[model samples]
Target: MGRGTAAGTVCFAVANQKGGVAKTTSSISLGVALSDLGYRVLLVDLDPQACMTFSLGLDPDQLERSVHDVLVGDAEAAEVVSATEDGPDLLPATIDLASAEALLLTRTGREYALRNALEDLLEQQAAAGTPYDFVILDCPPSLGVLTINGLTAAAEVIVPLQCETLSHRGVGQLLETIADVRKMTNRGLQVRGILPTMFDARTTHSRDVLDDVAMRYELPVLEPPIARSIRFAEAPAAGRSILRTARRTRGAQAYADHAKSLAGEREAAS
Candidate 1:
């Protein structure tokens, strides 16, 4: 319901209904980049797949508690939050999250579950003088209850669009979902813009797709598109972001620049 935390934590949901669009990658990268800028960040693994959790070097299967516990009312978010080696705190996910939808469907005001949990956590953290500067929600590949919770909780949504024809196909539908979330749950929710990922300037198709989506959806396309790099694939294996694994790579630099711009925007707004 609130646009940000009392301590000014800007929440972002990196969402795209389509899979393999670098949603998790962007989430982890941005979180780490923000942390590198000396801000405290929290990365919430809302996806049942737990890709972000594992990518951050945490094993979802071995975890005693997770975000699933928080969402199901069995545990508070602070109780389940863990520190990642990569500089950000994480509310990890497990396969049990796959059942959260069915369980939440029977609960009243289910869509606000995440928003309420995070608000409570923020209050607790702020009281302790350890407030986060950013919260990044890595949404799943489907517009399910989990994704709805993410949208309802975040003040802004960053849609990661792979530079391909089919990648932009679901942008319209996702936009409609955001609009509905605004009307029903989080009226303060806004689309940060479409983030072009895995862009290949060497190909005209990549350039064309980026141009077409911006014009068609009338959404701001963030500058310096993330280029395709094998380093992105290798980082997960190393349990780090591209920023750490390949610090000097173009893809890593793009995310750093993006994070700086985001931090600057928040500063400007304040």
Candidate 2:
């Protein structure tokens, strides 16, 4: 992969195992923000509820195929992927994905199911000479089979953390889970960093919680905490990311900066 080149696809899982942390929002925003910088991006919605799908103006109920189909071996990933007006491609999700956990449990080598599927997808894309530059996995709010598949498939994991005491509750559990994944499935897996979301600089408590979290894990804290914004909640209703809906807002700028940092990291790694 060349420095800042779009040739190599970088897979990152945005996970927290805790709902309301802006996991889906971060995935979508970051994907689009990267696309804005001219990278071909793909966002995978691993949540059965399909918030990411619905956020992009795609109706999960009307979809004939989704990530669920791809995971269960019923459809190719290319068949389910759809282009979004926001510029990134999406492998959407639906309620059918709720059955994936039970289905994967019975199969041998189940943890590698997504890894195998994604590898085939990437190979097919590369053969055609139109590979994606970034693949962002939006994990559900639980560390189950689906989340494990993401952890297994990704080269790095970005944890979207809420700046609250209760929000930090799952950090330890997720780290322990990642430790297990590295030993058993993905040895190269690394935590990209913790992204503080839904932040409020007005309150000292938020700042304190952020400090406490950094000390707890000694993990890199991705900068420019996404400020608490109703614009985020409004964007989904408009079928767009904050980058599109509130382009001039601090939230949008934060995501754009985060994307730039990610690109710089890729170039440095290269």
Global Cα RMSD, each model: 1.0, 2.1
What is the lDDT of every predicted structure here?
0.93, 0.90
Cα lDDT tens digits, model 2, 1-270, are 112334477899999898989999999999999999999999999999999999999999999899988998999898889999999999999999999999999999889888788778887888899988889999999999999999998989999998987777889999999999999998889998899998998999988898889888988888989998889999998889899989988988999999999888776776
TM-scores of the candidates are: 0.98, 0.96
Off by over 4 Å in 2: 1-7
lDDT of 1 by residue, 67-150 (tens): 999999999999999999999999999999999999999999999999999999999988999988889999999998999999
Give candidate 2's error at residue 105 in angstroms: 0.5
Error of 2 at 134 (Å): 0.3
Clashes of each: 0, 0
Best by TM-score: 1
